[model samples]
Target chain A: MEIADDSKNSKRVVFVTVGTTLFDALVRAVDTQEVRQELYAKGYTHLLIQIGRGSYIPARSTSDNGSVAVEYFTFSSSIAESLRSASLVISHAGSGSIFETLRLRKPLIVVVNEDLMDNHQEELAEELAERKHLFCAHPRTLHQTIASMNLDSLLPYPAGDAKPVSKLINKFLGFPED
Target chain B: MMRENQWLTSMAESNGIAVIVVTVLTLILVRLLYVLNRCGKSLRPTTVKPLSTLIVLGSGGHTAEMINLLLELQKDRFMPRYYVAAATDNMSLQKARTFESSSSSEKGTPAQYMQIYRSREVGQSYLTSVGTTLIAIAHALWLMIKIRPEVILCNGPGTCIPLCAIAFMFKVLGIRWSSIFYVESIARVKRLSLSGLLLYKLGIADQLYVQWPQLQRKYPRSIYVGCLM
Candidate 1:
């Protein structure tokens, strides 16, 4: 489906949050001039990126006017607010970020940082994707995935039940079902 | 004769007061033991009035695990769930709303969410942590007295330390209203986190659960329930 009218300026904002950890590579990839032009064409009028503790700052380009205004922040106190306003979210594969984005029922694309110990984030991302809750992309293929994403075909995230955990709690609470 | 009579009367009055005090103390002691016994009875399979459970929600991973646990348990079985988190940790509070929003749609009472002062920020100085810990303890005590939940549940977190301490205190005093349960976070694979270690060493929690098999084997007391999240 067509995301935006070619004649009209798109007002949809895309929020990319890296959580509290550093994700400089994702920031750098999204910050490039080529990526900006493609995102603007895809009906995203504004791009808000939370870089966290990342070292690389997205260079502010003066020539890019009304098409897509790029903005970046080191951290944000009101991520919930940003998530609420955002049309789409691209996040690092942290459980906290993944669950929150899913809870909001927002269309999310999670990119896993392979550098982390234990590779837990990748595990979480794969599980969430398998459940059809979100799409998972590796940092290497992030830009390509984002560029080719067909919003209309995006599947609805299933809000998985906590039956197993609840059962355990009930057993511990001594109210196990007969 | 008059002075001797007065002295005897005064001694009798003092003794009378002592006897009354002793009687009251003995009755209180008996009641305390009974309460403790009843709290212990909760471990056995019996019909309880859908216990009031207070879950300590730590930020990030801790909150996720606890939320997952809450989802599995029957909503009706645990009536009037209470959530406590650090005052600064708004994210946990927001995440907890998933349970509240789902539970609120149902017929009965709504869940209560309370934020206590954080004992310390990450990378904070020891002296600062000490100062804040005192404040957190006072807040915890008030919350414990107010909620008086039948069960106190939490995954490992620094904020839970004060609340668990209060629960342990109540248990010791034979208040026995809240039974503490500590579930170690999923992040801890090799060993217990600082909060888990403290809870285990202090013998504060009545029941402890670990996500990994190794933790259960090493700790002995911790029940290995596998992964929650």
Candidate 2:
């Protein structure tokens, strides 16, 4: 297969990191032909995925220019770098991923794995979405949600004040508050 | 008759030694308490200098919650901070790095990070847990002595137990001046986690805080501080 010059040099990259836990559902959803075509149509030149310990390996798809566009692995030591270069981030609703993405002020779509036992990610995702920081979807709705997502509506991540924590720390340290 | 006489003589000598040992132990205990009291007085809230704090960052959700809590702390007040992680938990270390990098970039001061051995993971066997816990105690002791933090903070995790135990022992021995502050994780809305139960039941923590009012009713001493994270 010959690679297309347009895809080879295209700038838009999507990063999806599912953290260290096995999130096969998210991987399978993202790997469907429909989702891949939608992403390609939207000008996503590259899709870098960190699938964790998930068993389902995404099949490599070659463009007309034979450039392998969608790349995935079990894990990476360079997740931070990937996050920096991404135009959009789709991630599990893990707090580490959420906070890091927010810190970088990236357009984020969080898909919570409801299959997890006693997962509080749903609560966090709902709260963050309500605050307009990011758009969230369950694993079942991830593909549809991403396909229809409007990047323009996302609110930039907000900075947090130290007031609440400061009060707690002061009290713990036995310092009387002014 | 000769055996009876020897037994009486042996008992008398052992009794004398026991009396001497008790007297000496009591005297040492009194002296230790006096010295500790003096040291505690020096740690009054009026100290102008900033404090060195030690915080335990457990894996996964615990790490995220602790980082959130640390973000709210007045960075200027917590000098030379230390964050502890378990040896096998690379994910926690990575999460902690975000805090270190963000703080250093923003304020030019980076926290000291250390990883110690974990007593046991949830599914590990009881026999291995015992062996690893002993090793964890030694590591915890060495780190605690090296840091000698004025305040030690942790949420609930098995790793924190050994470290807190060592800190509590040092307090009893009057060899260190540090206060243990335990904040129950927000996830534990009903009952305390295993670590929390141990620390609270043993009265090891100087301050115990619960994240919800429901838990406060269960543990009388645990102050409900709402949600810190």
Candidate 3:
């Protein structure tokens, strides 16, 4: 598990978990320490990092190039629990991760996996974008989306209402009401 | 007396036009009813055995949704213990385990979970695809004999093929059968995929639960259930 130094001090932290798959393209696209520093300079302590499965370390650190505190990690159950507990979660559009985040009612920012053969994640991101419950950022629009993100304005599903989907399923299976 | 005569003439003309319009409308309604009745008769319900055990076959996000639905149903009078045949080792199983554990903590009934036999390791070969399907068929048959579910509710694609084939074999062996295919959401514009084609070929499904009203034309025996989660 890789922990960011800034995460310890930041008031408003952005936690990310990207799995290790030997694919560095996704991590490289949004691994911006400069943007994190910019946000920190604006009095917004932003800790942007990749931690968990499919993460790879690039040769040169983004911070060394005058970027902010961005970190990376491999898979760990404890780290995942911490990511879930964060104020906001930024992650790839993997269904398992996204569903877990949604179940917790945490504000989410999903960056789609475009390099994959199927554009399934892209489709899912677009659908969620229409619902206005999540923030979607592509490589082209990451800077703008990050700048515009209003943490206070985020409205996740009410805690108890997370099971509406499960209830809907019950009705479909012709389960008699209790 | 002359004014009275003109009034009668106007009333007679209006009545004649009304009769003609009603006749035309009745003819159209009768024709429409005939077509609908023909369709209804063609989709006659085949007798299916009562399903004691249900096997849901899917992978990925759709599978997660399906499992959640199944777990919810297990709480009620309809407790159909399920067997999941996943195409890949997706997160659906993990999510399912979490859901089951959470539910078990609340109540006490452990949600039953089982994995179907797959012929080959993940991403082995195209040749293994056929073998995996055969294994799926054998497993389904063994389960059907052991538990004997009358209806198999298919979410989509991969799992449906083997299950439906086994169900058809069961039907030939004098066991009654039925199937329900649940469509989650309808696309604004309909585009048919290879899986959709396979669904049509199965020809054993008795009812299709379509989420969108516009998709009614696609399935012969469709019931509009709005969005099915």
Best by DockQ: 1
Cα error, candidate 2, residue B13 (Å): 4.5
Clashing pairs in 1: A162-B72, A166-B72, A166-B73
**Best first by lDDT, ranked:** 2, 1, 3
Estimate TM-scores for all models: 0.61, 0.65, 0.63
Candidates, DockQ = 0.20, 0.14, 0.07
DockQ winner between candidates 1 and 2: 1
Question: Model 3 residue B183 lDDT?
Answer: 42
Q: Write the per-residue lDDT of candidate 1 for residues B141-200, one digit (tens) a residue.
A: 899898877778899778889888877667657675577778887657667877888887
- Which docking band does candidate 3 fall into? incorrect
Ranking the candidates on DockQ from highest down gives 1, 2, 3
The model with the greater TM-score, 1 or 3, is 3
Identify the runs in model 3 with alpha carbons over 4 angstroms from their true place. A1-9, A19-23, A33-55, A58-67, A78-80, A148-178, B1-51, B57-60, B74-76, B87-112, B117-145, B153-157, B176-178, B181-197, B200-229
lDDT of 3 by residue, B2-88 (tens): 999899998999999999999988876675454333321222233222234464645545565566455545443333445556646
Which runs in model 2 stand beyond 4 Å of their true positions?
A1-15, A32-48, A62-90, A101-162, A176-178, B13-45, B59-80, B89-113, B121-127, B184-192, B209-229
